[model samples]
Target: MSDEKKLPLRTAFAVSVSKTAAALSRATGRGDGSVIGGRLGMMIDPDLLAHLAAGREIALVSGTNGKTTTTRFTAAALGVLGDVATNSFGANMPTGHTSALARAGATRYAVLEVDEHYLAQVIQATEPRVVALLNLSRDQLDRAKEVAMMADLWRQALAAHPKVHIVANADDPMVVYAAGAHPADEVTWFSAGQRWQDDSHVCPACGGHIQRGEAGGWACANGDLRRPSPQWTLLDGEVVAPDGVPHEVKLQLPGTVNLGNAATALAVAAKFGVNPIDAIPRLGSVASVAGRYAQVERDGRLVRLLLAKNPASWLEAFEMADVAPTLLAINARDPDGLDTSWLYDVDFSPLRGRQVLVSGDRAMDLAVRLEINGVPFTHVKTFADAVAAVPQGRLEVIANYTAFQDIRAELDRVL
Candidate 1:
């Protein structure tokens, strides 16, 4: 590391101390964004960035899915403009984000993926220049009130922020509504031109009906508009044409769900006056976002990690797999996970041909559902157990946000 990049030991120590204390505070009871984000808030609330003008910028990516992907893409695109600091490890709350800033020493920009529930607190504390709200869905039923209920909370939170420039998914009625009503300094909409929409949940604004169009993308029957056909859409080809990564499609990641995510990131950049072509190259540079559809090579076998804790995420994971030969699942509890009720809601019929292994704390729950769904399975009681039983070929593992650490850690150890 360069001398300029090196931070003072005492400063780092102090930041660590504060983070430790804050994390401990939330070690018990139901922890909200109150402590997780507040710790970093104490570090660099608004006052601390006063003198820094290397065109310092902070960007926030929040929503149910693609927050991490959007955060990475935004950071990558902004990195083209200047030096960037980001929390790619998902420490997106205020405190964790602050810790990243502290570690970065001096940086021109900061990109973070803030959680949906904590959006208000994170924004109130960090004051990002741009806030991207990805499509919301049914996630964490145990903790979150309801998908629509949380959507209302999201609207309220975004409405409170006035200075931040916002980018929203126009295809999602809820997201569009939030963006359209945001009191931000400025707002822009981004869409995939009516492709890859997950709008099956219907419009959260008007009681209008939403339908899956012939193209399989979601559309509202009402005049509620989409981002006017995004100026930047991912060209389809086998991974090499749209730009060059090499595959059957112009995707660095899997699933049409992620194609929408990629499109959203590009649109957000274009909305910021960034040329879509100029930023498209950056997308090629970043492909596998951790815990999303992160494909890792273990020996010669491909093990794709599908981070699917929510109903929509599970749906996306299954869609992307295309019924792989073997599938594995992990659902361990850690990093504040919730009970698994949304599992019963996921559609698993396409998985009939694939052999499956389910693990995690809720492995039995998923296995039972799989059995009822008629998905043939192999036996594995835990991630460790699954590791012993994994076949040597293309494999898929869908894990919750919390199980990511445990499952990935064990995979590294044994796979």
Candidate 2:
């Protein structure tokens, strides 16, 4: 029903082939098929994304963490408008993005979760109407640039594309510096409250020490940098709008972190003409994002999946864990980040005084960290073994990237 332009003959052929490849890939159970389809499309036409995204309203979500969840929330909130095509399976890169758009059909709106490193390329190709900059921290050190370098890249990208309206997290110094690079009028700031300040101690502007005050207040030693007065603020578990009205947000997902994600999504939704009251309830209806907070029943046991990829996310995940039996899985796969040194950065103190089941390829490494933290843990060889070790009641399972996917796949096989 969209008035969007039709694809060129060659590009249309590429899309058909890609869709057929994706169908075959899904039927064969080789994986999600997003990557294969997108790869083949790109092989046929390097500009496949531009063709697919033509005449559509695009919104891009980018950050070090929470991009997947925030993209889901933003898409759900925008659903009040109409059909929103999104890469909900966590395929955020160019190939996956191409696949998502290629299959979007007549959908006129898209909410895309973009990799932080590829934000500039995607923005240039799609010419998104709104861009959500969540937060920045060290992630995938082996594959990603340094935090400062990423900030600089974002600054340059925003400066180059001044027409794109930006919704950025003001609480994060790196995000502040990056988004602040654009014309101030083009940016709308939101403070979701930073729980992990260990990585943001130094001011990105002046390299001076950053100060954190009580109740999410922060200032920099140098006068050049400080937390901006956010247009949207999450105060006391509610999102406060510019009109000084508080909209209570209840999420099926757990943790204060999800509250922050909701606030960010609301800001983006408002930019797209959705009222905060309408968008807030739509965001709260999101039960789970991808497999992040999914409650799966396997072998007569309820296992809740929680994902944390870095120290910042891990700190938040630990806060959300219940006192019930817990399973911690860590992997050093390419997707999970090979450098396990970040394990030491997390305060595993909450895990103390509880019997923790540690499993994954890097279980022993986590065991050593837990031992030093004085957390009682048993290192299991397999995810099934770890699940079996937990008592037969409500259980919590937290894992890094690859481990989380493997556990979900294994559960799907049996359940």
Per TM-score, the best of the predicted structures is: 2
Question: What TM-scores do the predictions have?
Answer: 0.77, 0.95
Q: Write the per-residue lDDT of candidate 2 for residues 1-415, one digit (tens) a residue.
A: 2223544776898898888888899999987788899899988877888888889998999998999999999999899899999998889998898899888786878999999999989988889999999999988888889898899898988788999999999899889899877888888899887877777888878899998887676888887777888999877888898788999998999988888888888899889898988787788778878778988876767889999999899988888877788899999998887899999989888877666899998998999998898888888888788778877776888899999888888878322
- In model 1, what are the clashing residue pairs, if there are any? 37-94, 40-95, 237-249, 238-247, 238-248, 238-249, 239-246, 239-247, 239-249
Poorest stretch of ten by lDDT in candidate 1: 45-54
Q: Which sections of candidate 2 miss by over 4 Å?
A: 1-7, 413-415
TM-score, candidate 2, is: 0.95
lDDT, each prediction: 0.63, 0.87
What alpha-carbon RMSD in Å does predicted model 2 have with respect to the real structure? 3.0
